[model samples]
Target: MFDKIFQLGLRDILDSMPSEYVSLKEAVEGKLEISLNNGLKHRFDAEEVRKLSSIVPLYLWSMVRIPFIMVKLSSPGEYSINGSEWDRRAISLILNDLGSVISVGQMELLLREFKSLIFITLGYDSISGIDNDKEGI
Candidate 1:
């Protein structure tokens, strides 16, 4: 069906997304690599990792996952952070405050500040054709 084709197309667009996430603690402990959906390895920036470690509390280091997933909403210039509470808390600390939705300007700021710690992807709604259970896409 056309829906299946559409889902495949959406998934293809996310082929470069990370296959798995690493915790901040793991990154700090020299486990700074993640596998991508395309079977490629992506390494985290050491300096960025150090900076993040300094910004976030020690207690959250283990729970906060690296490469925070930012979902681009269906609306233009809007995004939602997709991750656990710990992940959002770390981001909130970095940004001073984080709302349910973030604007494009905020996204740019986050990219500049946490270049190696964030990943942008299409929102579930944007990729509604795709199944939610699919991992790494």
Candidate 2:
């Protein structure tokens, strides 16, 4: 039906997204592989992993997931982390800000500063309208 076709189109938009994420601990310990939605294996950069490990505390190693999914919201130039508190906390530590919503400038900074440690994707908000209270992996 038309709905099925539409769904497939939407899914294709997220084809580059990771199907699963590896924890910081796993990455640091040398398991730096993540599977993409298209069934492709994406390897994390060892140097980036080492740099991230140095910034985040040992206690948070297991809690923080690498390639943090940064969701682009419905609003223009707006994005937010689609992750747990620990992920946001780690980002806050790096950015030195407590805000959940990231602006275009902040997104640019994140992409530049932690290129390999984050993933950018279009959120459901792009179609369903903005919902600030939503939380996920």
Candidate 3:
């Protein structure tokens, strides 16, 4: 059930996103770069972002002890989840590649972008609304 919904949401998001935001090569390589307002940059590889995407969501859900929750859309293609909202240690666990120099705001922005890319590359069901098992008309 979770997988089904996840796929559906992913497809919907991917279809609506712009062409530049949906890159198979970047998704596969897991290469991400974030530029902060402070004129600094942080680089993340595919493995790092993948780990963050899986870990951060689970951690948040674990705290609430819920199996699933409503994922609100804060923007056109971005979910409401902010990774920077997590504790400093938790954020460090994901952005360790850049050491402990990143701020909460920067991490949050990066996370939002990360989520966008993840949805593009991860599970996608093009036939989300179409039922394949239906009998012939």
Candidate 4:
């Protein structure tokens, strides 16, 4: 239900954008469209949309994978992202991109999480003790 509304809103924005921008961005993004009686609508290549959406999380996870992989290759007690610049940037970019698809407030909160993840990824801190604010959520 929520995703439907979200997609509709995105389509609406895409519809209002100038054709020149649409042709450029949509071409790069591999977008398609359909026409209705009322107006033009953004149409996604169905399989590509599904696959791209699925890969988002994988991209997020990939941000943390390198250090662990390298640690395993070396003799180590356990593989973990104790302090890594890659993790920080990777998580930041992922959430920021996700934020682009949501409302501004939601974007702020997501960025906050991304920051916290960076702190954790680096050895500076971890969320071992604090309970999250469920009401805010």
Question: What's the lDDT for all of these models?
Answer: 0.83, 0.83, 0.37, 0.32
Cα lDDT of model 1 by residue, 1-137, tens digit: 99999878877768888889988999999998899998989888999999999999999999999889988776667777888989879878887875667788888988987888788888776555443332222
lDDT score, residue 11, model 3?
Answer: 63
Q: For every model shown, what is its TM-score relative to the native structure?
A: 0.83, 0.84, 0.22, 0.19
**Superposition TM-score, candidate 4 onto the true structure:** 0.19
Instruction: Name model 1 segments beyond 4 Å from true.
Output: 1-9, 127-137
- Candidate 2, overall lDDT? 0.83
- Cα lDDT tens digits, model 2, 3-118, are 89978887886887888988899999999888898988888889888888888999999999988988888777878888889999988888789887888899888787778778
Model 2 per-residue lDDT at 68: 92
* lDDT, model 1: 0.83
Per-residue alpha-carbon lDDT of candidate 4 for residues 1-137, written as tens digits (9 for 90 to 100): 99899668656644543232122123224444534334644353445333333434444433332111111112112122222444434434444542111334433453343321111111111113222221111
lDDT of 3: 0.37
For lDDT, candidate 2 versus 4, the one ahead is 2
Better of 1 and 4 by TM-score: 1
Q: RMSD to the native, candidate 4?
A: 17.4
* Model 2: ten consecutive residues of lowest lDDT: 128-137
